[model samples]
Target: MRSILIALPLLIAAPAWAQGDDSELWLTATGEVAVADKTSIELESINRFSDDSGGLYEIELAAGVKRSLGDGWYIGGGYVRVVNYSRGTVTRTEDRLRVQGGFSTDAGPFKLSGRLRLERRAASTGDEIGYRLRPNIKAALPLGKSDFRLFAAHESFLPLDDTDWGENAGHDRMRNSIGVSWKASKAISVEGGYLHQYRLPRNGRTSATDHALTFTLGVSL
Candidate 1:
């Protein structure tokens, strides 16, 4: 446990070791409500600010529902509306539909989880539908008996189908984050982290990297 805790800071700082093209901030508010036994609904709002994109570059609003399948397994799906802005002007909008399933389990003092997501994305700038696959894993460890926990997560974006609006059918990008979560109360938690995003070079495009400070406020009811 001590070794793992020591490595968490390295994982968080690894992105900064690379040459990042942009600096950004991401803020998210998420809430979950139990509607039935073993079933819940989640709603999220995310706002992102970017330096190169002229600040306040993106906004996402999403809602989803999940049903626990017993013994640490679950399935869910949701819709997201994404709006892109440049220099405070709205540039494009996107609609995304997602279906996902995953599992979670505890290993000694560590909690591990993984999920796979399938997405269908449609953009206002193009008629071609884009299909994407995202797989992610996360691990968390409690800070002794305190209400704070340390966590690290990685997610990959793979484009399954090509589209005119810059979707190249291949490995697209990845996100890595390291952070700590605080249980502020029984129903509220807060998380703050450093997130690194790297986009693979494809279709004559140069690779891009983003360093972001991320914060999240989560509520459960």
Candidate 2:
């Protein structure tokens, strides 16, 4: 398990390294609160810095609620506000609403999960309401009986329709991440990882790729 985890990033990153065009850093903080026996609320903040954008380029704040259906299945919905910055100035702002369903199950020593999400997005720079679909999958392995776990995840972004702002009607981008998470206590946890994002060329746009170092701090209550 350890050896596989160590090699996962290298193997996944080989093609990305050859095609990556930008470097970035991403930081995120999230909090979750149990509101009922099978329901919880979550809040997240994400900040992204990009070499091409000169500095901090994107910021996202999101709030969501999740309801467990028992038997490792769940449903969730969320609203997100995204702000794009360029050279310390705000360039565009977007509002997004998403609904998703997912399932998680234990497969031997590995914990596996997958989700399918649909999103409706409105941006300050565009008149059309963009629709998107996202499919994500993740796997995690516990490191002995310790407080740490190794994980890998992949997600694809598919635009359901063309938008004036930039979203084209087709396969958009995908993200692949490999990381380690440490549970600091019952209430707090931390994660760090490498993420590679590749955007497919569509509607005369050139393909682009970004390599990012990602970190997250999470809290639960």
Can you write out model 2's per-residue Cα lDDT over 49-118, one digit (the tens) per residue? Answer: 9988999999999999999999999999999999999989999999999999999999999999999999
The candidate 1 region of ten consecutive residues with least summed lDDT is 1-10
lDDT of each: 0.91, 0.91
Tell me the TM-score of model 1: 0.92
Number of the top candidate by TM-score? 1
RMSD of each: 3.3, 2.9
